[model samples]
Target chain A: MNAVKKIVKAREFTSFLFLAGLFLVVGIINPAFLSVDNISACFNSSMVYTLIAVGMAFAIFIGEIDVSVGSTMGLSAAVAGTMIQNGSNWFLAFAVGILIGVVVGLVNGWGVAVMKIPSLIFTLGTNGILRGMMYLQVGVEQVNSLPKEFKDMSSKTLVGRFTVYYCCAVLLTIGIHFLLTRTKRGRYFIAVGDNAGGAELVGIPATRTKVTAYLICGVLSAAAGIIFASRIGIVTSLSGNGYEMKAVAACVLGGISLSGGVGSVIGAGIGAVIMASISYLLVFMEAPSNYDNAITGVILITIVVVDALMQHRAAVNNRHARLAARTSAVPGGKEGLEQ
Target chain B: MSDKTPKLGGQNGLRRLWNGPNFRWNLFLLLLITVECVVFGATNSKFLSLTRIFASANGDLTFWYVSIFVTFVMITGGIDIQSCSIVGLTSIIIGVAWQDFGMNIWAAAALAVAVSVACGALSGFFVAYCGVQAMVVTLGGSFLYSGLGLLVSGLSSTEAYKGISGFPDSFKALTKTKIFDLIPLQMIIFLVLLLAAYLLLHRSKYGRKVFLVGVNPSAAEYSGVNSRWITMSTYILSGLAAGITGVVMTSQLGTAKSDLGGNFTMTIITACVLGGTLSTGGKGSAIGTALAAISITLLRFGMPLCFGINKQYLDIPIGVLLVVVVVGRAIVSNPTVIAWVGKLRGKGKEAKAGA
Candidate 1:
């Protein structure tokens, strides 16, 4: 019973369990899918998704969203891809890409925190502007022929098929996750997201915290763009289109709340692997790629409904326990329960 | 029944207009439209011609149709991004029914509308009954419907990329027909739609209930209104609007595809916000949506024709305009900005006195 309680309380546990069960189920149907190389390949492909989901987790943790992450990723990829293709220094290309993302993030933060505009509409507008700029930048030609070293970096693994980029991204995400959950300043993200007014009353500088969250989200999304360019070896104007929804789905799967103040970047990373593996899984399942969006939609609805039902049942059980302990003269049970 | 109040005219009427709740936004929209018109006309003289303006305006019949219902959803404090998907779904359904199932065009249109309404009910159920977030559910719904649209296209044995063309000439004439060689039929259709939406949204008892539900659903429920039912009904209404838009777009394009009205989600939402429909809900008008749609349509046309902008890049100005307008509105409404204006005025007065 205590084990059940612990598992229930640990939100990320379900996500990890789901991830394992997913791989098991698919592996059962196709034994080849269980191979270490194939599975590790899934992790490698999930690097961009993991990055964006972690970034999105930061924004969602702070009780907001940035739909422009897709466009930010796209614009970054386009600009960086262009520079790299044109023989520009790799560092310069990455700097320009990240600079654009920072500018977009600051604008979004100003609109959302300082100017008091809704994050959805603000980021949506940025999405449009960035996508359009990407279109203008890459007219009639995709950016190709990135440097050999950068292109090879995605597959260059020291021990096993795990790419250095995915490893680094995972480690960075875990580090940030610890900082967010364990540090004093890190708690502000949750405090502000949980209740900005209450957080302000307690002197948390809710607006600054929210702004910082957006900045971090921006930086991470820009980093994902850099990784995407390196991994894909090319960038079309529409390279990252519709990726925002995938990231959002990953966050939800990872146990992050859309309404904010819950979940972890580690969970988002796991969820990203699950989400990014769907198209690859399709090959083994012999299903057409057209089912990709539908499958994602079904998974999203299923997990959310399951989560909601579990929460509801837990609430009901808690209420019954409290009532039973209070009204019924259960001395020890009542005393041992939380106040 | 108390009809004895004296009619106010001229200055009094102007005063009433100024004091009205949506007056500033409405006036701002009007001035902005006029300024856009003048600026575009200055850039290209051909843009100012009335016939050309009307011709360009008639092209956005689908947007005008979608915006009216978007206003309805926005007024209720929810958004219907899935309406764009519904347009695609409805268009594909009609095409498949007509071409593959050998159904009559009109009957196929009816079936498409019914299916769209069912889609709305599904999303509405989650939002109203399950207490899920409207945006997230609709976002999911959008994906589901668009995918379903593609699946249906696959079932039709038609390659999805080819789309379903060879629409009947009569159906094509439905959108192409002009009245008296001067006025297009779409203008009249739009005007009638505007009147119907205006009456339904502003001049009806249900409209009052909708507003109350948006403003405070709990209070409305206490007052005997079924808030969930009201909310669900608005989505059905919006779905019906999307169905109409699908038919119009199909006739206009003379084809139906899974990607119909691809950019309309943003376009219509921009129209609603630009025209004065509050995103937070409970404050929008069909008239405002219409005005905004017209302005946006003109901007879409003028940007390319007058300023030589590539069609692909038009989204930049549209996005920048949306952010600027919403942020500008926020600044205008902020108390600190108002106080600063007053302080600056006081400082100017003191400076004049010293001079």
Candidate 2:
């Protein structure tokens, strides 16, 4: 039992260790890397990934994948940019952005729920479609010269340290944790993911639950896109080309099982920070920028493998528990259990 | 194989013509060609000339020219994002062997293919034997191979972006050579590749194993099949094909760049999905892939020709088409329709019983 607990703790804390290790490495490379300003900037920039990963955690927990999130984010960004250019107010532009995200999410949910298509293929398809739509709508002109309000968010440093985006990231993380732990919808998501048939037997609508997962993913991804647009102050067709991978890597590194039914919003956020720091540290260390991708890949794979091993150990422990329970029920049974 | 579901025939053919994978592929291709001819002709009458038409088509075809290997990659229930990097690596190698190393073009191409196969084998070993997820393994492979490509090219030239140009005329002649001075050699190569891929995938016994492994590895293993090696072999074939594509691209463009195939993985994967290769694996066809490549290539060139569409927005149509095809397939296969039809027929019986 003690060993099992140890394993669980290790599995949970590995991401934190990696995050700390990256921080230390960066600080070592450049003393100023640990400065409040630098740390704030890194966290602020990583907010996009954190937002998307939190959204993706819901889908991953439900045993589904959403590669289309990046493209969906792009769609929202393009929509928001176009709206902003057309003299739309901030409130209206934000609503349109969120609406596009929800619509894309609905398309994903509808395809998976109603059409019974696999999530991966359906999302892959939509990834292309959303990207195509962005292209058709935006064309070649980059949406530039943004309004003062949006630019202020991108350039402003909040609370004398962190940017507003970083604050948003913290708020999102805390909100997700509360949603998962306190809300009925959150428990329903886990219940459905843990066993769909069982959830259905208990009067839970598994399909609806799964669709909700995708819907949340859509909204979150769109939010991430809005933040990204604000940060960069530029809208390009390929802006969100590879952001999906970053989210997936973060979730995987954060002990979110790809097989689903388990993940933590806090852990995923930490994973995002770790990933962001790798690139940040590489620059501090004077390493080639390209090495950042390679290192990030390595860290992601390592975390995934460790998670898999932890799960395997848990399965073995469960099997052993059943065997011990059976033996203990027998009369005059001599059961010598060795750990 | 199930007799209960009869193949689409007669009236079904018309329906299938619009809805089936084959129909969509051909329709998209035709629509693009028509639009291209009309727009280019209006802009410049010379664009309508047979020579110019042939040139445009040839250029369009080159974009997805490497899609032949992507079909095999899809069949094995694996994806090789690294194949794009392999293309770059091979192109440079081809250049070095033919120009600097002074090897024959054919021999150089063979060497390039061999290297690609080795890289593929490494990735396949990890995926099939070690049970690593295809995505992670390939993503890592992409980085490793791309880095190597840059390094190798950098060894030969300082400007990695400019690439290694100035290949001998003979090497470019392979892509440019005309049979009867009417058709390009590149076209012939594309046809031969398509036919060979079809035969290997659809007709061969080993090919069937690939499908089984992809659909369900546990079931295949239980049935006394070594699904691992079969899956591994497909990656090897893909890598080799990437090498061939690299050589062809280098020869055709008269340059070899480390970044030649960068950002190409998404496009190839898009082509595979567009061709109806289910990402979940176990279902796809060479003919479907061929048509898909043609359509994608046409879209790349044709959209720009007619609508003055930006090249970057190309992902939009490909993305939309992918979603439409997948969602359309899903809707048609929805069980509610058949259940509704059964209920409608049942209502007639209930009414007669009441009477």
Candidate 2 local lDDT, B51-163, one digit each (tens): 55457666554335566677777777777677888888888877666666778878988998898889899888877766667776777677667766755665563366777
lDDT of 2 at B177: 88
The DockQ score of candidate 2 comes to 0.37
Candidate 2 local lDDT, A233-317, one digit each (tens)? 8888777987887788888777776667777778788778776777777778887666665576556555555555666688899
What does candidate 2 score in Cα RMSD to the true structure?
A: 5.6
- Badly placed stretches (over 4 Å) of model 2 are A1-12, A26-36, A82-88, A305-339, B1-66, B92-111, B154-156, B306-313, B336-355
Candidate 2 C-alpha error for residue A116, in Å: 1.9
lDDT minimum window of 10 residues, candidate 1 chain B = B1-10
* Tens digits of per-residue lDDT for model 1, A90-198: 8899999999878877888888998888787788888888989999998768888788988988889955778899889889988998899799999999999889899
User: Which numbered prediction scores highest in lDDT against the true structure?
Assistant: 1
Best by TM-score: 1
- Taken over the whole model, the C-alpha lDDT of each candidate is 0.85, 0.76
Give model 1's docking category.
medium
